[model samples]
Target chain A: MPRWFYQLASPRWCYQITGKLLPGFAIAALLLIAVGTVWGLAFAPPDYQQGNSFRIIYLHVPTAYMAQSIYMTMAIAGAVGLIWKMKMADMVLKCCAPIGAWLAVLALATGAIWGKPTWGSWWVWDARLTSMLILLFLYLGVIALNSAIESESTAAQATAVLVLVGLVNIPIIKYSVDWWNTLHQPATFKVTEKPAMPVEMWMPLLLMVIGFYAFFAVALMLRLRNEILRRERRAGWVRELLQQQRG
Target chain B: MNNKATNACHLPELKSGEISFQPGRIFWATLVRELNLALRRRSDLINPLVFFLMVATLFPLGVSPEPSVLSTLAPGVVWVAALLATLLSLDSLFRSDFDDGSLEQMLLSPQPLFVVVLGKVLAHWLLTGLPLTLMAPLLAVMLFLPAEGMWGLMLSLLLGTPTLSLIGAIGAALTVGLRKGGVLLSLLVLPLYIPVLIFGTAAVEAAVTGLPLGGFLALLGALLAAGLALSPLAIAAGLRISVSG
Candidate 1:
């Protein structure tokens, strides 16, 4: 294994690395998100179709994308942990669940909030929205299963299997839903098939997506550092770190 | 992970620690064992079907009883009820074996765990999925589903329910080790269930509208084929996880 990859296997090493990286990510996330929100909300030209309501996509699209991306990350992390017996990978898997779930919620809430103004209904079984709801359920299931299991290793492995299974279904769910939508013709608007968009509208959306990814990194590192501290509290390095902190 | 590196240092010997048995015979034996178990406990066979019936019954009472209304909703109501019923039966898929310690034995078997897992899943589908497929038409009738749609309902369930059984076995394998696994099982399985439900209901709706129903059924069939090939491996992986822990 390469030096960096090998180093990542150590919880203490991981904790230290994340500690160093967290601040950089945190600052970047804050600046970018603030810029993106202000730019998208205030400056971007309103859609010719939906007018002002379309601005919510800056929040909705990125969070929705992150919601799916984070779950995929958890699955990959889990496979690495299960296959390589990498302890830190399990930490990644466990720490990301609640963050991913809430991202799904934020995406759903923002989508619904946006929907009321755009679609004249708070919720519609639009394919994308319905799939997001199911994603939330999948995240909650992993969380619920983890909490239900008594042994930490057992929980990790079980949730790993589940995350993997859910990963496989994501594509199937997406395709089936697209097919169903075409069959049912339930569209209030076909926003999915957007033609060429002006760069001004898309630029802030790009910033928000990047910002969300950075924020996810910061959030994951924070939770994982806490997990490492609690799980490895009995280790000599943790004790040494605490003493160093006290000094 | 390498099986050798599972840190599974404790290799409990099976009653008959033989791996030389033919795969077909081993599969047959496992299937027969599960069948016998399901037969002995009649409720395992009946309860889910009963639940399917009752849930389907509630929609009519809960919603409008107009035949036109019921007919339009029949495809969805019946499919959802069938989906939930299969989920109800999935909780016990690996529980009995785990509790009796046979799951550990199966894991350590010279026979590939995938084959044994597939046999058990096959038995599961036969006991639950097959019966539900048969029972669906009755529910369709009760829901006032158009006669034209009856064949679609039956065929879709026939093809689709086994996919549910296969996909759900992964959830069952993962959760079989937990104490309160019932609700969690549904939570884990239902998202995966969406595609199957969508196509199954779509097939029936297509039939109701006199559209070409073959396309939706073909999709459902494709799903079943994929489920059969891949899901046992996932179920095997899940069983290994629970067993290792």
Candidate 2:
């Protein structure tokens, strides 16, 4: 392994690196999201069918994207922790669940808000929406399992196994849900599958998605720093760092 | 210490000393042991079935009891009840073994944990899932499910419940070390159960409407195949973490 990768296993190195990277990600996330939101809401042309109600797409798409990506991130990090026995990877996995769950909730809420105008209901049981809801539950399950176990390492390992299992099942669940939805509802006009969006609309969406990724980085790093500190509080470097911060 | 030494000497020499990789034997031994234990504790075997029956009963009482209403809801109601009953029974899957230190021994044994986990899950399916499948028809009748859908209900449950047991075992193993694993187990397992429930109910519903059953049944079979292939690895990993951690 490369030096930097190996160093990541060291809590002190991880904390230092995240501390350095956090501000840039935070600033990028803020600027991009703010600019993207304004551009998407005001500058982008309204959907011919839905009008201004389509603006919720700015929030919904990014968060929905983030929710799924964060889950993938969590599961991949968990696999890394399980395979490499990397403590920092475990911390990353542990910190990811809440953020992912919240993003899923945000996606669902925004989807609901958007749904009222587009689908004429707060909830449509659309396949994508239902799968997103299930994804939220999956995140919650990881969180629940993590907190339920008394030992942190054990909890990490257990949740890693679970996240991996969830990873495998996600595609199956999504497909089954899609099949089930189609069988019952039969093509309810998928909102996101519109004919190629005008650049003005899609460009902002792209920005928002990137912004969400940056924002997720910021959130994950912040949580990861705290997790590293908490789990490594007994180590000499942590004590030194604590004293250094105090002084 | 002296008594321990004497007891060790009382065993047959080959039985005491031999440590060979006999996965088939380990699988059967674990399955038989689990079956034996489950049979001895008759309540553990019966409780989930009773729960299944009662939960199915709730649908008719809670919803409209009219035959038309229940017959329409029967497939979903029966599948949901079976799913819950399997989940209800899952907590005890590894609980007693973990408590009794046999789980630890199983982990330490020369045989692969995969075989042991598969065996245990098979035994669990036999005791809980199979019985649930057999009892489902009676519940379906009470719920007024159509005669045509009966084959679909039983076949779907037969195909799906084993997958349920396998997947639920992962949760059960992960939570085996925890005291209040019952609720948490459901929380962890139920989301994963969604696919099985979808396919299971879809099969029955298709049968009810006289749609082609092959697709749904085939999908259910695919899920069971995947579950059989993948779940034991997860179950073994979970068991090790629970036991060691």
Candidate 3:
């Protein structure tokens, strides 16, 4: 077990390490997502029923998955910060908010676009759509709460509590389709049960999922680096790094 | 043996008799004091009521003068108006005390803070929430809800609005110190208020359609009980952070 993961709790060490890793992750993310998009858009077979409109699912599903997972990630980071008083965990939670909100927006936009073609309306008051709208509001609430406060730590703690409370909505959003006679369709992808799609559709989706994760990792590292530098601006290593950049 | 008997004889004196009042009496006293403060602030008492009435009256102009259309939209319109009215009342629940020094004084008081917060919340429910419940029957008529659903509407409001107060207290406590807190307060609390809104409207809708009100009212009552038990603790914790920071 390399010590860098634990050592990164210190702002100076995290700043130094992520500075090295950011470029690599960025390049890798760009390459992978590009390949995934080309493969998904050009090569993947159109659905026998929905045709080209089904292509939106490639972006919609992955971002929706990321939106939900990132919230859980933020909440877990918040729990860690609350329990162990870890500065890195708090930093991660803060950095996660805007990224999560943007991802939520992407999910909602893609969802609405998908709805227009499939359901003949831009929006519907179905369970899945309603719950996802609520999720977007929860993200906005956390981000708004975090920014409105003057003190960093107070903002962090307050937003953390809000995030935990808002977690109540997550399971509801997931099961809304099942619990109600929603206009939206039931989930097609399940881990335990066999997938509904043939290998062609699922493979592109799988690649896109991996690409989304890589993109998230790259974005998180960049944001975390910026946060660490801002918090550690007075440190000697930061001063040296600044001098090096200036040179 | 004689010393033991002497100690036993002194046991009642050793246990302080001054702190033995019933908890219920203390709660009542706190609630009374909160109510008195609320009444002394006349604007707080009247403003939310006026806002509620204004909102209910606006619907006819915004929609149509036709009774059928108004009656059809009445249940949702009234419940949404009430939710907004409750939200307006909620903004002041902690903001004023927080702005002045009163919240600090209460926090420093030897009384348990949860009891104190709960007392304020109850006073809020009585002064603002109770009035809404009383006025609901009149508004229900204006919105053209069936005459029979009036009682059911009142019953549902009675059970439902306290939960609104409790949940709103949590939001108000969280944002008490922030500048321009009103919009954020709505954003934070509205999602939590969904179950109440859903069941409340359903109760009215059921009554209008001549269906049974038992299930919806039961759900509303359960939600209120849960809010009463849980929200105070969250509000208290939020209060400490808001004040300390």
Candidate 4:
């Protein structure tokens, strides 16, 4: 095992290391997301059924995917923090909440926008939408709990417990439409199903997913770095780093 | 002389530990103490009940008072209103104890903290949650909920409201120390409440249509079980943070 992985558990090490990685990840994320957006929006074949409006999938699907993924990441980070008492894990959990919530909001907005043309209504209590809305509320609850408390450590601990308890709803949200007969269409992106589109369509989608992941990585690194600096501002090393930046 | 002193000290230590660790006595005593405190505050007991009645009354003003229409809307309105009333009651759950130093005393007690927390949650359920459950029939009558669905509605509330109290405890515990915590408490607990709302409302709806109540009741029971087992642990943890912070 690399000593640096454990060493990065220290906020100072995370501050320095992620600083070096940030620009590289930011550039890569921007390049890939741009290429993916263009390729998916302009070049990909329109759906035979939904037509050009299907292009919103490029933005909607990736964010929806990220929304769920980020919650899982938050939960895991919370679990690690609780079990190991790792400060870095708590930082990761804290950083993930707002990003995850924003991603959920984006997914909901884009989904609603896409729904207007396709489903004839802007909103419905369909399982998929309802579940996603619930996910948004869960994110909000975590953020609310974190902010309600005066002490950071206590807020983190309280939020961690809420995250763990709320995790039961995640599987329910993911499967509710599947288990019950519902107006919402079933899962479209199943790996086992034969491809419904030419490579031209799915290739860009694949790219978009990868791009979104990279974008999240870049954003997380930046936020994590800032969190480290703010948290460690009283430390001599932070003062030195700030002075160096100023110089 | 030294032997007498040692025996006397050891005897007191052993007796104290044994008495405090008696789970049954500790649980009931904590529960009783919380109930006593809640009752001693007349406003706390009366406020949630009044809120429940007022919310139930608003439906008639907002919607048509035609019996059929009111009956159709009754279960949902009553349940939603009860949920809100529970949220109102939750605002005071930890705030008073936290302010008056009772919470610190509870924490420093020899009893296990989880049991004490559980007792507080149970007392909260009795004061806020149970009253709502018991009052459902009266509200249902006012709202024109069908007579047939009455038992199932009551049953659902009986089973489901405790889950609400338990889940709400975590939010209450978290926000206990915040200024103007009422709105924040609702925001924190309402989303976590979706499952209970779904199942609880569904149970009453199912009964109105003469659908089997078995499945819906089972779901409510399962939720109660899950909440009962897990929420105290979360509340206990939250209380520690809120108190210590």
Candidate 5:
């Protein structure tokens, strides 16, 4: 085994490491999200067209970005688990699913809330939202498959394959849905694409995006630590740690 | 047929790992065995077609039965129903083999796993996808589909559904080991099916609108080619994981 890999694969090492790292990310998430939210909501100028409803972009864009990023991370972790047989990678893959799904839900809810004011309805088959909706289904599918399979290693391998397949399909789905939307309806608003937003608007958006990712990191570490403890409960170190905590 | 596995096990020559590079022989045997099994349970073969027809019938009842409304919706209606029928029949693709232990034998065989998986998917496509494609014209007429679009609907289905079987096989192989995997199989596979569904339906929609549909059909062909190249390997890996775990 490689020297670095051996250390990286150690559950005790990761648990201890994350314990040291979690507070920093948690604090960063709190400060950045708080600052970005207030600045965007109260200070940033309203959209020239959609007006105040556009404020939801701060929440929607960041979550939508995190939702896809977390899925990609899960896929990468799953691939590592399969190729290197890293048990920690499996924990990372499993732990990321629910958080990714929640982010997708938040993005969708915000999009729907935003859509009601701009598009005149709660839901339109807008390409981005439609693709995000399908993404939510994809996340749910991974969660469902993981729960259905009883054995840990087997479930991990199966989900690894599913996630990779999803990774291949995502771009194709996005393109096809985009094409379908164009054929059926005119193009709608894109948060990332604008007529060169003044820095006053985008600065807070960037902050919120970074904040959401920091929050994601904090949540992921918490879940990964819990999973490590649960899966490694039979290990000697885990037993000793449990005894110490009990005392 | 279940006994062929046990009978083959007793043949000393077959026990050697080097069974020559005769994938043709293995492929034929697997396909024929699947066909025989499918033939014996004739209902399994015909049920999807029946389900397809019944679902198409419900559209008329659930929606307006007037011809104008039906014709406008026909392409989407036929395509979505066909996709569902393919999914309904996917549950049995690997379940019986897994239950009967032949799947384990195939896994143990030195012959390539992908070839045998291809044979099984071929057999599945032959029974389910072909029949649905053939049945589409009738269903299209029943729905008052425009005369010009029938060829596009049938051709798109013919090209689209084998891809469905190929992709769906990966899902089937992954779940075949579980006690209750039918719904979970759909959950796992349906999102992957979206691209094929989109292109397939788009072809017919293009035909109805008098637009060139060759591009859409070409995309479906590309998806099928990709599915052919990739799906069996994924299914083979999934099967190994499912069985060993």
Candidate 6:
């Protein structure tokens, strides 16, 4: 392993690095999201068919993407924690669950808002939407499992195992859900599956996606920093750091 | 002393510094022990079957009981009921062993934990899922499911519930150390159960509509194969974590 890889196992080092990286991510997230929201809502040309109601995609797409990506990241971090006994990885996994769950919720809520105008309902049994809902449940399961256990490390390890199981099921769930939806109702329109879009539309979408990722990094680092302090409160460096902060 | 020496000379030679490990023996022992224990608790054996029947009955009573309406809902209703029944029985998969400390002994034994876990899960399927599959045909008839769909329901349940048992074992093992795990176990396992539920119902629907049911059954089989290949490892890992904690 590389030197930094080994260093990551040390909670003190992880806390220090997250502290260093937080400001950069926060700034980038703030600037990009502000710009992306303004541009997507006002400046971006309306869809030829659905008009301005499509602006919700700016929020929905990014959050939906982040929801799934954060899950994958959590599962990977879980695997790393389980395999290598990395406390930092466990912390990362723990912090990712709520953020991911909220993002899944945001994605679903935004999709509903967008759906009312386009699909003419607050909710539809659309494949992507249904799978997104399942993803949210998966996140809730992880959170519930983690909270149910009293011992922190045991909770982390057990939820890691569950996360991995969820990881393996995700693709299977997605495929089966798609099959089920098609069997019941053939989709007439695919909102996100437009073959081509002019640059004016996609650019903001790209910016929003990047901003969401940066925002996730900011959120994760913030939570992970607190988690490190909480888990390592009895360590000597944590005591020194607290004293330093107090002074 | 002379007679003892003659008897020892007649005995088979044993290898020194070599440990004997028989996974087959451990697997059978765990399976038989789990089966015997489950059979001894008649309510544990029968309650899920009753729940399966009651839940299946609920749809007809709760919804319109007309044959057309019941037939339309039958596939999903039967599959969902079976799924819940399996989940209901999963809490006991590791609870008794964990409570009595044999779980720790199983972990410490010379046998591979994977085989041991698989044996327990197989035993779980036989006790809970197998009974649910057998009773499903009655529920199908009660729900007004078509005659053609009966085979599909039975076949799908037969193939799908084992996978459900396998996956549910992971949740059960993970939560075995907790005091209140029943509701949490459902929350954890149900999402994973969705795919099987989807495919299983789809197969029944196809059969009802006279479409070929090969593809959905194939998918269910694939899931069972994947579960067999992978879930034992997860169950074993969860068991270890729970036991150690």
Specify the highest-DockQ model's number.
5
lDDT of 3 at A238: 86
- Counting only residues 3 or more apart in sequence or on different chains, how many pairs clash (N, Cα, C under 3 Å) in candidate 5? 0
* Best-to-worst TM-score order: 5, 2, 6, 4, 1, 3
CAPRI accuracy category, model 5 = high
CA lDDT for candidate 5? 0.88
**Which 10 successive residues of model 1 chain A have the least lDDT summed?**
A181-190
Candidate 2 clash pair list: none
TM-score computed on alpha carbons, candidate 2: 0.94
Clashes of 1: 0
* TM-score of every model versus the real structure: 0.92, 0.94, 0.89, 0.92, 0.94, 0.93
lDDT, candidates in the order shown: 0.86, 0.87, 0.82, 0.84, 0.88, 0.88
By lDDT, highest first, what's the ranking? 5, 6, 2, 1, 4, 3
lDDT of 1 by residue, A1-247 (tens): 7899899999989988898999999999999999999999999999998899989989988888899899999999999988998889888999999999999999999988988987788998867778888899999999998888888888988888889878976774456456645322232224686536687888888889899999999999999999999999999999999999999
RMSD in angstroms between candidate 4 and the native structure over all alpha carbons? 5.1
Kindly list the per-residue Cα lDDT of model 6 for residues A137-164, writing each as its tens digit. Answer: 9999999998889898899999999999
| Candidate 4 C-alpha lDDT tens digits along A171-202 | 98889988665877776588789667788988
Q: Could you give the C-alpha RMSD of every candidate to the true structure, in order shown? A: 5.3, 3.7, 7.0, 5.1, 2.8, 5.5
Candidate 5 chain B has its poorest 10 consecutive residues by lDDT at: B3-12
Question: Candidate 4, residue A221: CA error in Å?
Answer: 1.1
Candidate 4 chain A vs. true chain A: TM-score?
Answer: 0.95
lDDT by residue for model 1 (B68-139), tens:
899999999999999999999999898878887778878886877778888899999999889898998899
Per-model chain B TM-scores are 0.92, 0.93, 0.88, 0.90, 0.94, 0.92
True contacts kept of 1: 0.97
Report backbone clashes per prediction: 0, 0, 0, 0, 0, 0
Q: What's the residue-level lDDT of A152 in candidate 3?
A: 86
* Model 5 chain A worst lDDT window (10 residues): A180-189
Q: Which ranges in model 6 have alpha carbons more than 4 Å from their true place?
A: A173-195, B1-18
Worst lDDT run of 10 residues, candidate 6 chain B, spans B1-10
Worst 10 residues of 1 chain B by lDDT: B1-10
